[model samples]
Target: MEYRVLLAESDRSMLERLCQVVDDTPNFTLAAKFQNVSDALGQGAVFNPNLILLDIEQPGGMGLVDAFKKVYPAASILCMGDKWQAESASGSIKAGAKGYIIKPFSGVELQESVDAFSRLGSDGSAEILVFFSPKGKSGKTTLIANLAMSLARKSGEPVGIIDADLQFGDMAVFFNLAAQTTIVEAVRDIRFLSPASLSSYYMPVAPNVSVLCGTRTPNMIDKVAIDKLENLIAMSRGLFRYILIDVPAGFNPTSIAAAEASNTTFLVSMINGAYEIDHMKRALHIFRDWEDMENRAKVIFTRVEPCDAQARLELSQKLGYPVTEIIPNDYAIVSDAADKGKMATDIRPDSPLSRQVDRLADNIIGRKHRIRWAGV
Candidate 1:
């Protein structure tokens, strides 16, 4: 499908250069170009381009971000300016740009940004998947790492995995990413969060797969409120095709908030552990009480050994929840991939375990002919 783009820059020469580059790109057409933010805002509603390339610093020193957002809320805006002007970049994001490309960037960079925005239009709502377990060592991080890559690979779309486990999250370790930025920093400036600012906090782990690692300090958890978390997830729905949130164990405020914000909550557990069963029951009880959560909860049994069929049956019967998918106890493959900081989907795409992950992705994206596990 052809994409219509609106390029808005006060600099006439730069606008011409960007137009030329957009013309050369495949499946993209420049619907309009404006030398001032006012002109862009005046025509935005009528033109209604699918994507917008906006300049933060324009004539009259007016906040172009605010004006354009007021006019066109659906168009994905790409903020352009000097990278050092972080405040302006942040402001533009707060005003509702989907992504941002710094000034002096290559033509390739502009083309890629446009392409990402174009893909967003195809996926109606960005699919967000949150992975949470009752406690640590339940393979939540491992599952998320593999699942993020698998979803991206299978669907050929952008996928984001967030380590919402505020304290003691190991998502970065599992992916070999340095924990430089955390959701803590992003939430601190929650007022400025939009697609562009959200994109700035992400660390790309693989092609079309990015991660938002959790904060290291427990105190940082208090910095992120439920509303901020919900807003972040809501804004993310515009940029990503799939989002996997790696939630912390136990029913704390953050975990509860994450569960509420997610479209589907995969209550993960393991077989042969009475504590796991008890935790699952407690989670169910909590979900049952919350009037808003009854429809969005599903039980996913992880690390199930073939010999533990009886235990699995008892657990499923007791909880009255269908065991959506039983991930086999394959520590060798899971642990090796985790230790090496490589995704299992990348290492063993043809393996039984990999096939299971693929199936899980299909279920999450609503591609398979199975019953809807959650209302969403």
Candidate 2:
């Protein structure tokens, strides 16, 4: 598990500091260190490094990115700069750098960067599904979490959940994971991140369900730019089989952007006394105007009563759209599971609610239905 590191920094002070840090870091061995760009490019291959921490801001440093990328195509190239230089970082990324990290970072940060890069693969294709609700209290988070676990289990692949509910996301509480790294940081540094590096930001709650949390404060939402959020979603697609985004409720920029990026957007509404159907109708109209959404988008009704064929038909007729799913109200089981930071299915595998979720998972994976609901 040891990572062979090759570092190149022209600055004497910084080079010395980084060399000392790398030498002392565990599971990492400094294969080589150079103060000159030529020396690094000339002898980099001999080291056979797993990671190359290059100073892209140094003289001829930017050009070395392409040279190393060509020579050592398998190595993880990470550009290090004196500060957060967006333009230089963007250039490094364009030239094939996996990511960029600010200089003077601690040993832990360096290890994290290396570890993140190690987790990536060549293929980045994944199914991106965004779970969006017209308003709050729609059970969107609950549904997404359970569905994520189900999909992971069914597919036998890792599933990633981006808690895009920036203002007040409950994913951390739902999964009972500590907010280690939030989406705010991921979006801020996404331009310089890769699939391997992106994995570092997520907290793995289930065996195959990884979660990237939301902002700790509500005001931090404005800091997550639209382009950054888009990039995060795109990068995640490469690393996982299914990317589930729990977007903020309502038709804000965050929700809209996530919905657009997803291959399948589930517009969920709970059968509460509120005018959720009306809200969903309006939301559908908005999405229908966008490209590819008319067919990719579907409405899901949660907390439905009876959850039978007749109820489904009546609700679909009332909403004027085909209801893709009707999740029955299982308040006691759901509440107990949520309190324990577990999915309801885990608590009672044969419960009605779990059966409905299982069917939903089966449908998503193109499986034939096994549910025997007769003569409604």
Candidate 3:
């Protein structure tokens, strides 16, 4: 199917060159091009393009990322900007960009971005996965680590895991590596980001798994704005088959923005505590109004002990939502693996807990397989 795309760039020469490239590509047609944010927003729902090419800095002093979301909900935006000014790329993704291409990028990068968006199903593929929890000690990091491993192993596709929990993130500790490059550094050079540059910033944990750890100091988090986080995820989407975000535990703007930017927001919780349950309920309430939640909010019950069966049932019943998956409490296995910087599934592939994780991975992949019945 042919895609009608809108291009918004302040550089006339660059815009024209990009247009020529798009024209050369099969299955894509330039529906329109705007020089500024005002013009693009004013056109509104009329151009009705399937994809958008947006500039980070446009006229009218308003961020192009913010305008695109309000103006074109159906169009998946691809953001572009200069390296120094590329900080706005993240903002664009938070505002709903499908992918981001930094300035000084090539036709190949542009084409690849377009192709990635095109392959998405009518339901909108989940190129980015954001996992968040409102309360601390809720096993957010572990979930992120395991889920990333699960996705990599099951899909046989590269997965990029970002520990967005800047202040207290322990993803590096879990991986047994000192974080050298972070999302902050990547955002600083947003303009230079391409498929090739992205690999340099990401620390490879496995053949198909890479991680971008958070800052060591809490103060460093201030350097990262909502837009940068969004842009980072957008760029990652183009590089990895899946981008999993491990968010800090809170309702801050950063967390909210991450939730908004994600294709699926996994609210991880445990069944033992009333505080966790109540917090999960409040989070659900908060997210129900979020623009992305119409089909994306999933409550995953983690660290489930066998004795907590009743509470789990009550929690599911009270929430009126199916628990997507119940990760059993296996502290010995989880802690040991985390300490050794190994994935639990890798260490205990035959364990029942690992089987549950495999099942979760299968469900996420949405595959169909035959089932045989001995007696029917």
Candidate 4:
């Protein structure tokens, strides 16, 4: 469809440049230009444009998108600014702006931005989930890596994983990916990034799964601030249907921030010794201070030797917190898959581990699932 563009900007030079770009681009006609948004909205109807290119760098400009929308219900209002800001983009989008773009951008860039915001699904925001463990080597990363693929396949929507373990993250290594951009860069650039633009930081690994890799080195953790990481995750809600975060073992600023942001956090552990139960009790005691700890913080024991309903019930009684899920040990295939940089489910579909992972995925999506094995 051809676009009749109405331009509104306070800067004359920028206005002229915008007019020129609109004039030169195909299927985009320069309908009218105004130095003030009030004049533009008051006299906008005479031109009858379908697209309103608004310069949002001006004071109170982002706030006026809804006013313009009320005036011209048919036109698409695209916000442009001197620099990108997450708050401004979120505010404008909430106020009915189609999308945001930075100044000195091309007609192609303008089109893509508008197209992206217009394509946002109306299914509400993403469901954020986090994986937390008392210590590392509890199979947290393995579960999350496989879950990304499972959720994407079952839900038929995009799935994203954030490796919040800045000091010792191995998400890229798990996927065998040489990520060009990591969470560190994303945080550094988040001040100038909008939801649509933030997609560049994530590397697509599977059909519908993508990952924001962690910091490149252990020391780089200092570069990733907690507040910035939260902003990164908040802006990313518009880009994916489900976001799974992997926090470093034990409690820290990063891990706490991730868990607090999530709708639910799985407190994962491995079946090693009786001391593991004591560790969980200590952790759960800390979680008791948080609201809704029982429902929001779930417990899962991996590599369970006896993964049965009876075993799960007995373990739940022992821990006080119900066992949400228990994954049986499938070491041989898992080792081989890890060696080859493949998911256990992908390589061994019939394996007990694969079946349990799929069932876990089922539980996550609120789908009714049944356990196949009667007894362990």
Candidate 5:
């Protein structure tokens, strides 16, 4: 098929060069070139360009991605930059571009990048699970990281971890990953990202599992816009079979957005105090309006002391929701695993903690009967 190409660059000479490249390339046609983003936005829909080479750093450049996505959801948007700006590139992706490439490139480079979209296949949706706690210190991150490994192993499918707990996300540390491209940059550049390109930002921690580290700078969490996050999660769904997001505790913008977008919102609580059930109650109230909230919502009580029927019954009665899963207190194992930066699956496959987490993963997969709790 002849792909319609839109080339928008501020540098006149560079723009002319790219235009020539597009014109000379077979099966590609230069549809239009605008002086600025505004003119492009004004004329983009009329041409219905199938591919766009955008100058993401220019004024209105960022907005142009959003406009094109709104108008031409099927079009592939590639951000054009003089040099790779890892940070700003994420913003471009968030705006809805397929990918970002450094300029002064050959037609071959552009063709390879644009053609990657076809190899990604149709954008597929993923089962999204968001882990949230009303209060911190619930071991949410640990559970998610371990669960990711379990889910991937059991399903034999790709799993993605989006550490949305931007301020204090520890997935990178827990999984023994370095600070590379994180979700913050991923979100910022989501607009210009395709499923193939989006895969570039994740740090692979295990087979079929990748982690998008949260913002490295704690304060940069403020820069993670909630709307963009919805977009990021949506786009990521197309890449992985399951997307597990560890959100910040409490009802904040980031947490709420992640929760709302999730197919299953696991309300987590570590029974640290007698009022822990009360905390879960408050959190449940917030998700009352969610679709089939009861079915989609799950209450996970971690570090359960005397994890028995009586304790589960009492908690269920008080919280008015069945205790979906109970993880016994295994401080030593958990701490050891965390210190070693190992997933529970790897640390102790047969341990009680890993067993329970694996069961939870199975339940989420919905391919098994209800788990009959063994003695804690």
Candidate 6:
């Protein structure tokens, strides 16, 4: 199919560059080019454009999305800007734009943005969440499962779970999914895959939720490079609305990389271990230097007896770091859900454990998370 692109930009240099680039791209035709929004709106229809690259930074530029739609209803309008602007990207999407891209972006970037953002219903970015545990048996996997379920149910969008434990991830076992391909295959083939093709590697375990299972054997962990895993997560952002990564327990490269990539990192510990608080304290001190560590990284303690505000405050005071949330634990419900291949939220939605997870899901969506690291 031919992509007859109409370009509108206030900057003359950018307009020329976009016109040249679009004309040079495969299957792309520079239907028309203009230095301002009004000209595009006035004459864009004559081009019969199926794709439009519009600058959203100029005065009255963003407001033309609806007009462009009215003029060329068949065109896929991609908003462009001088730099990253969340409000602009969101507003363009809300105003019927297919996606947003930066100025001087290549044809590959342009196509990728449109294809990826189209996955979301009037949204652009995904919530990359990292669930970290100081050690194994922190109930992090269970937390991911229930929270993912809640998120999927509430949003009715695709949620991705990447079991990055490398050695002993139980995501497939918990979901009762027999993986035909695991992270190993994904990493091996990642260099040759696109968002749509890579999606085939993930197994659909629940409605609107998919799991990229870990290696079939512990030794296969070596095949799953940390860089590749991060790249996999990056590529997945285009595909999933909410991506929950279950990193290996402890502060290894995989865990650190995942945490750094995520907008929110849930640093989880449980009451079963007496040393958990100390471990959490150590992790907090290490993470303090990271940008917005105080905000993006949440301190959570599981299996607490009280699981109250007082407990959170006391623990926060004890650790010299704010305790963000707590989970009330009853092994029975979690185990029962796992045994039945169902979600804890599905089994006991009103249970304390499930309720806390539901609240967490809400927080993930409702909370304002800073998307970029500062001083970049």
C-alpha TM-score for every candidate: 0.69, 0.68, 0.68, 0.79, 0.68, 0.74
> Which candidate has the highest TM-score of all?
4
TM accuracy, model 2: 0.68
Question: How accurate locally, in lDDT, is each candidate?
Answer: 0.72, 0.80, 0.72, 0.82, 0.79, 0.82
| lDDT tens per residue, model 5, 101-182 | 7676777766766654443333334678999999999988889988999998997777999999989998888977886798
Could you tell which candidate, 1 or 2, scores higher by TM-score? 1
Q: Candidate 4, overall lDDT?
A: 0.82
Q: Per-residue alpha-carbon lDDT of model 4 for 1-376, expressed as tens digits?
A: 6889999989999899989988888788999999998899899889999899888888777678878888889888878877766576566667777666677567776665555545444433467889999877889899899888888888787889999889999999989999899999999998877666788799998887899999889999999999998888777866777899999999999999988888778999998875778888888887887878876888888999877788788888899878888888878877888899888989887888888888878777762123432222
Q: Which residue pairs in model 6 clash with each other? A: none
Residue 102, candidate 6: C-alpha displacement in angstroms? 17
Q: Please give the ranking of all candidate structures by lDDT, highest first, separated by commas.
A: 4, 6, 2, 5, 3, 1
| lDDT winner, 3 or 4 | 4
In candidate 1, stretches whose alpha carbon ends up further than 4 angstroms from where it belongs are 1-116, 289-295, 307-314, 367-376
Kindly provide the TM-score of model 5 when superposed on the true structure, using C-alpha atoms. 0.68
Q: Among all windows of ten consecutive residues in candidate 2, which has the lowest summed lDDT?
A: 367-376
Model 2 score (lDDT) = 0.80
Error of 4 at 288 (Å): 3.8
For candidate 3, which ten residues in a row score worst on lDDT? 367-376
What would the TM-score be for candidate 1 when compared with the true structure?
A: 0.69
Clashes of 5: 19
